[model samples]
Target: MSRTASDQSLDGLADGSSVVVVSPERIDPDARVRDFDQLSASAQRLFVSEEETNPATAADLDPGDVVRFTDYYRVR
Candidate 1:
């Protein structure tokens, strides 16, 4: 699967570097979402990726250094 910019950046982060995970609210009301099962699967993938990346504490995140997940349906 093709990786998003955030995903690629996550891959390049140092094991102990500080980072932040932001799950933004879905803003497009008209966009179609998959079923509960599919959404759950997507969430699982996201969680696994995060665990693998294993970023350090978010106590001192920079202004723009964020891993934002915006579109739920397009996560995978």
Candidate 2:
């Protein structure tokens, strides 16, 4: 995959970036999604674990999740 400018910044970090590879088949269980409605039902439950209870809020998200989301989705 081609790395965007944002993705490039994460390429060689010391601690390593935490990545959740969401395929068409399945998403990681620990991801905290921003736009839950954009995902399918199964994707929603799997990729958006926090939203199952929190629903549309990002207060409980980790810093990594936010950075990954913005980098991948270009939220900025």
- TM-score, every prediction: 0.22, 0.23
Which residue pairs of candidate 2 clash?
A: none
Query: Whose lDDT is greatest here?
Result: 2
Predicted structure 1, TM vs. truth = 0.22
Candidate 1, overall lDDT? 0.34
lDDT of 2 by residue, 1-76 (tens): 1222333444463433233333322333564445545544653343334322321233334343422333232211
lDDT by residue for model 1 (1-76), tens:
1223333344454543333332345223443433323334444354335453322122322223333334322222
lDDT of each: 0.34, 0.35
Q: Where does model 2 exceed 4 Å of error?
A: 1-4, 12-29, 36-58, 66-76
> Can you list the residue pairs that collide in candidate 1?
none
